[model samples]
Target: PEIKSWIDTVLYDSACDSQPLKDKFRDQLGIALEASLNPRRKKTVTENLPKGMKKLTAYGNLVCNA
Candidate 1:
């Protein structure tokens, strides 16, 4: 969870780190989020989470907080 939070913060603040690290982390997040939408969670691949959040609940919470 701490890792996820760190990644999220890093991704959100692109100017704070190397572009390669941000890009890699963003791509990894996309892959994980894509895998997460695989259907076991009663959610379709077409489910619309937020722009960057990976988990559905996190997606909801992030968007709500935004």
Candidate 2:
């Protein structure tokens, strides 16, 4: 009975200590999943061109006739 009580106490303490770590892991996973699903748009080279120079050919290549 004494050994059983000690084992129970140890297991309970371990579970309590693990709860915060589990929560942190879950939060990080959620952030990673959210970022993957809704990624931020990166700026393209052509996007920074002037209004008149912002032209793309039929094949989507930039045409700088200037």
Candidate 3:
């Protein structure tokens, strides 16, 4: 459960079973927890459409720019 907590809060501190400076990778990249390496989001997928349409919208109707 600790690992899950770390991931949920965007927390990471070094690596497990790894030397402090064996590869000096923390600065180059970043601390990667096992939980973050594998995250799964559960949600439903929906394709909104008109009452009777055989084509998909080319772009979203809610003007993103304005």
Candidate 4:
């Protein structure tokens, strides 16, 4: 819980905040943000498609940039 709160504070912190605190939170915050921004879901295969398609499904994140 404390770590989550700390992450929130760091994420919302302004540029006016002291440099040391920013540095302290940088690594952990980066990990949290990356994990959250890139999300993955389970994909399923169905028989409705055309023949000769590979049936194996891979579980992975599908990242999209707009």
RMSD of 4: 12.0
**Colliding residue pairs in candidate 4:** none
Give candidates' CA RMSD values in order: 14.0, 16.9, 12.6, 12.0
Q: For candidate 3, lDDT tens digit of each residue in 1-66?
A: 344433322334334535554234344344442222212233222346344544432342222212
- Candidate 4 stretches greater than 4 Å from native: 1-16, 31-66
For residue 13, model 4's alpha carbon misses the true position, in angstroms, by 6.2
Per-candidate clashes, comma-separated = 0, 0, 0, 0
lDDT computed for candidate 4:
0.42
- Computed on alpha carbons, the lDDT of every model, listed in order, comes to 0.41, 0.41, 0.36, 0.42
Worst 10 residues of 2 by lDDT: 31-40
Candidate 2 per-residue lDDT over residues 2-66, each given as its tens digit: 34322321212232445555455345432111122111233335656666676654444676746
Q: Could you tell which candidate, 1 or 2, scores higher by TM-score? A: 1
Better of 3 and 4 by TM-score: 4
lDDT of 1 by residue, 15-61 (tens): 34355655665676531221222233353233465565444442333
Order the candidate numbers by lDDT, best to worst. Answer: 4, 1, 2, 3
Can you give the TM-score per candidate against the true fold? 0.23, 0.19, 0.16, 0.22
What C-alpha lDDT, on a 0 to 100 scale, does residue 14 get in candidate 4? 39
List the candidate 1 regions with Cα displacement exceeding 4 Å: 1-16, 31-66
- C-alpha lDDT (0 to 100) for residue 64 of candidate 1: 38
What lDDT does model 2 reach? 0.41
Task: Indicate which candidate wins on TM-score.
Answer: 1
